[model samples]
Target: MVLLGCLVEAMHANYHGSYSSIQNRSSSIRVAHCMTGTPRTLYKEEVYTAYRHQVLDVLPGDLFVVLEHINKTEMIHGTRVRADNAIRYKSALKYLSPRIVEWISIGDSLGSIETRSGYAKWKRCFDHIQRTERINGMKYDFIVRTRPDLYFAKALPKPSKLPKDKILINPYYECVNDIPSGYDRKWAKNLDLCDLTNYGVSDLFAIVPRALAYPYMCVAYITDLPLAICGERAHQAECAIKATLHKANVTYEFWPFVVKIKHVS
Candidate 1:
């Protein structure tokens, strides 16, 4: 949902500890972070340090990252990215120790705005997160699907304070909290209060429950089918997410947390 300006790169990971020993079994709410996307100026301390203070300080969990395989440079939407920006993402590893890191060669497939292709890529990310979770023998109460570039405007709500059955997403349309104002206006068109009545769901971020994680993240699987949400409309990113949830009969609510795509580079 975010049109990023910075070049995307894989994290230069430095694993210092095993997650098995780090996670506290007695923690009331266990969260899993699935990070996909290039955050602007990731190497800066101001970015990751804020994440540590605002997000991890409230909800600590294992981090899963899927980055595009980029070389020295990449040009997207006529924007040229140099080698200096490539190395910036590496600095993020020092702050957030990731659990599983994977890379893929996206080439030029994502040069334009195509909903199906976008969701298909997300499908792979979801697969990686779920696959590693099973192999690691870890189960989380909620899975947070977000981007490394997201600027958390508010601390994540404690698990006890959120609804257990609904998908949590950034406020959109006419939902509660009036949908914060700092985010990109393009993403604003999709929130629609995370409902199907108007726009669709906000694709920028989603807090999926373990029960509906597959249906929520694996939306590429159901993008073609006639959805009950809009009934045979054009394939859209928000529509695809909302339709899949409708099929699963799962509802979504605004998380009340504000996040904007951080553009530092």
Candidate 2:
């Protein structure tokens, strides 16, 4: 186990090629975007078109895109926005024909309806992933939960490590012990002191196959952190946690790509 972990460690350092190099690449491509719409409306294709053009024009490859749908409360014009997300997924796949887009739906019945309620629903999505993993005959290989309103202003990047068996998530976002309330640090630290080699996990994005994501989500869900906290914190916490897990013998990595976009409509 130790030998295998050592191999993953050596490979991670070499893969990043120094922190500055990764940061330079990240600055060049920002991926997440926020889009606004009525409950039952289909997202505009033009927006997606423009986003794809901007990001893909810079980098191109197989991309794993995770879209999360929130709030199943409103029944709009006989249609649920949660359902609309699946439709949007279809539109995205068709609109962005050239790029490989894999979509996953994580929905909740809580949110804006009430802050506490919303958090509860978010937790459900995480619980679902964990339960799904125990099924005897399941199909999904990867599972992700993200905000429904989020849009991709840029093209999503291909995960650096193999996606099937490794856990990958944005290393820049994770839970930490102590720091300024709003300070942003792009480096990975604090989590550098653990041994987790029995599992293959990566920083930030937690890029893993269906098998690993299931368990990872279970942990996140059971812990009860706010969605926004999870998302924003991953930017820094992910790096630290991923590195710590890696050092502990967890086989994981930090994937480089544009993962954020503007929230403006």
Candidate 3:
């Protein structure tokens, strides 16, 4: 009887020891880069190539790419190029590789209401979050919202320093000397930080915790933006997003990142 009891105790200890070791192994931060929106003027091949090296290869977590299927023809470098949604979709799957948790393809048509395109873009991002959670049964610690048209020259800043209740955003270019003149310089400066004016936060890239990700992404659905803002789609989206965060009492941090726009003009 004593020998049997001793054997059970030894087995229990070994099992817990193994469990602890497994936990330790996976303690590294888990991040998810959610790339949303249409592939407009960007070259699908080159964009994915840079994404492979900059994001997938460098970042140490899963990727979820959500692309809208919009068949728009535009001139690229004075050459007419038909942006084929199907080809770009395939290219993403091929290049993103093993780190991709799922590639969500959403329809291109903006619904009955002819709202700004930014509304649709934000909606797609929200959909990706819901779909990813359903598939994995777990949420990512950090979520990055960015577009495909922008090319990253280096890996994104790690998310270990971000607070759970705050959203991290990329710094906007200074207004006085950065942007082409004629616009309100004071408004531009205010826009750089989260402010009440409708100038808008930088819409290029944002890193947020799971808690704030849902609210930030759902800004489109909850609010109806003004006509002036709607006219400027990107800026309107940024304003709405920042406003959402502000309402929720979620703070923000500005992190500077220099990226090239893959526009062939």
Candidate 4:
């Protein structure tokens, strides 16, 4: 196990080149973006034209993934596998495993169902990542949660540049996707973290350490984010995710990476 981990880590470091920053990371890391929300008809083409160049090519790992199963696709592995909706996924199958999920109707409000499903995607993706670790008897040093649709003008920061104990999030906007949600560290200071937590973390992307992966990925496991955040009944993402994080006492830092959710079509 130790030998396997060292080999992957060495390879990962080589990808970034030999530098002092290389010492900041101890093991191999996997970065991923989830393909979720409403799928566009031309999504596959966009992946090659935009996402691949702007996001994937810039990042260091091949297993880069988020959640959401597109088409009949499955998830995270130690090898290079692309999980997408109606897209072709892969060059290696030796470490790839498809996650079969059975869907059940929530009958909740449409927003609620969407919210739960989104978080479930994160949870399930991480589970698959962890499963891969077990199968190979090795663990990733870090895990990144992102969506494939975010248009990035610059490369997301590598895990070596980030702190392991803090869940790294983007600076929040007052209204993302026309919703009144976004997180601010200043506003959260010294207050009941959960009370102010309804002001959600920008879900654009997050960098998580292995220690905090469970709390970071289990947002779907919570029964009601709106109620938990501010006593409402239905609010889908950001603020809801904030409530879950604050409740878990998870610490976070806003990394200065700039990106926006762009329409694929």
Candidate 5:
């Protein structure tokens, strides 16, 4: 009976292996998108030009931009920021004046969005991307989630090798060990290859496959982690979590040291 059971298991394994080997490879074209919104203060022409100059420097051609705002009509109608404003100059380059390929904006209150909180806002941005993908029949090999308020401290790191599992910003122990720690523990449990340590916070700065983002969107939500405030204060929580977490695979790269800070003030 034991030998017969072994024979059955081996046959099943072989059949499954053959089936998986024939699966088609996903597309390699990647789309790196930034999700931005308006700041509290109005900008002068020089400030706006400087902002545009700095923004265009780090932006790549292969990107899908998403601009979120509290009010779109007010913005486009010139009641908020004014049409002749530099904000318009930047917005025009992407979606309004003359869209040059991959830029768009959605009213913050429109659609099924969640922007009041940090974590919710990030997930809502992911949701927007997912809906856009479905509508346009677009599929990406990689999806980089970036923030608009961010200033590049260095060059973006080349993406790491995509593992068979999800690439998390934190360490690999939480998933492998089946232990409990960190914020959003439920979110941690749902992931196959995840980190409770950071909850992929640096993902404000991430490069992940589109496929992985689907499951993560529904499950592996970002939790509270140490954050760098204007490069002055490093959130100690994330630093501590990172220090304690075990490193199994080299799936993430820290890039703050490399980003060239173009705007400050």
Candidate 6:
């Protein structure tokens, strides 16, 4: 039997919440929190406040952090955050002190907006896992991909061991005409129009063994743009991931958990 190991990839913004809850439950799990995009103006201070409170208090097995800087000229929701300000905002991460941290430069030049974004998201998570394995010289049994902006109501249950070809994904809240309702209406409607039969995997979280994660996360690189771009941004993301997983020939099962999205304040 494969030994139980986990690598938690928390990508996106950091809001207030104790990951310690998870550590308390499983001391062996390694965490890689990846923060991306320009910080939202509405909750800039709040984001830092939460990061300092929750992320800084790392547990014993928390591996490292990947801080990817967004381009200053990039407009996210009509806001262009200055590079200097981003640097300043990231400076505070010093409190993570003894923990290993890496800063990566990111820009719009990576590829077409949708494809590049999807690629970057998956690449960061995959890269970190590879890095940890290299440094520790050990392979992980499972990899958990998640977002920092989310707050889990309780400890996530330990993933059950599965055949190397199988993965564990959370079921989407709903599917409107086969389109995931978790996406915005425009994207959802567009996806529904496309009528993709096997397109309901929630991108929010996934737990898979290292054997399958390599192919699953590398989907962005191999995705067919013409097919994935049929829907809006979120829809494009869904299609890319789903398409890639299908090509990789991986089967999935859902692991239930209660998680809530923390709004920007």
* TM-score per candidate: 0.72, 0.35, 0.65, 0.58, 0.42, 0.57
Which candidate has the highest TM-score of all? 1
RMSD of each: 8.2, 14.6, 13.5, 11.8, 15.7, 9.6
Q: Residue 146 error for model 6, in Å?
A: 1.7
Off by over 4 Å in 4: 1-38, 41-50, 64-117, 174-198, 223-234
Q: Write the per-residue lDDT of candidate 2 for residues 222-249, one digit (tens) a residue.
A: 3222223233344333333333333434
What local lDDT does model 3 show for residue 193? 35
How well is each residue in 210-246 modelled by candidate 4, as lDDT tens digits? 6777666666555444345534523646665677676
Of the candidates numbered 1 and 2, which has the greater lDDT value?
1
Which one is best on lDDT?
1
Off by over 4 Å in 3: 1-27, 41-45, 73-83, 98-114, 176-198, 224-235
Q: Which regions of candidate 5 are displaced past 4 Å? A: 1-27, 37-62, 68-116, 135-138, 159-164, 168-200, 215-264
lDDT of 5 by residue, 1-265 (tens): 0111111111111001011111232434444353433422213343334334433323331333334333433454555552432354354333312111222233333222223323233344454455445545665455555444444333333333333345334223334444333222323323556433334233334555565554333222323322332123234323322322222122343222222123435
Candidate 6 structure quality by residue, lDDT tens digits, 46-148: 4444444433343223433444554556467898755464455554444433133444455532322345444455555465556556666565655555544
Which whole-number lDDT from 0 to 100 does residue 172 have in model 2? Answer: 34
Q: State the weakest 10-residue window (summed lDDT) of model 2.
A: 12-21
TM-score of structure candidate 1: 0.72
On a 0 to 100 scale, what is the lDDT of residue 173 in model 3? 60
Taken over the whole model, the C-alpha lDDT of each candidate is 0.61, 0.34, 0.54, 0.47, 0.35, 0.47
What tens digits encode model 1's per-residue C-alpha lDDT throughout 164-234?
78787875534543645422222332444444455567777777887767677666555344345654443
- Misplaced by over 4 Å in model 1 are 1-22, 70-86, 108-117, 173-196, 227-233
Q: lDDT of candidate 2 vs native? A: 0.34
Better of 3 and 4 by lDDT: 3
Error of 6 at 188 (Å): 21
Q: Extract clashing residue pairs from model 3.
A: none
Cα displacement (Å) at residue 137, model 6: 1.9
Candidate 1 global CA lDDT score: 0.61
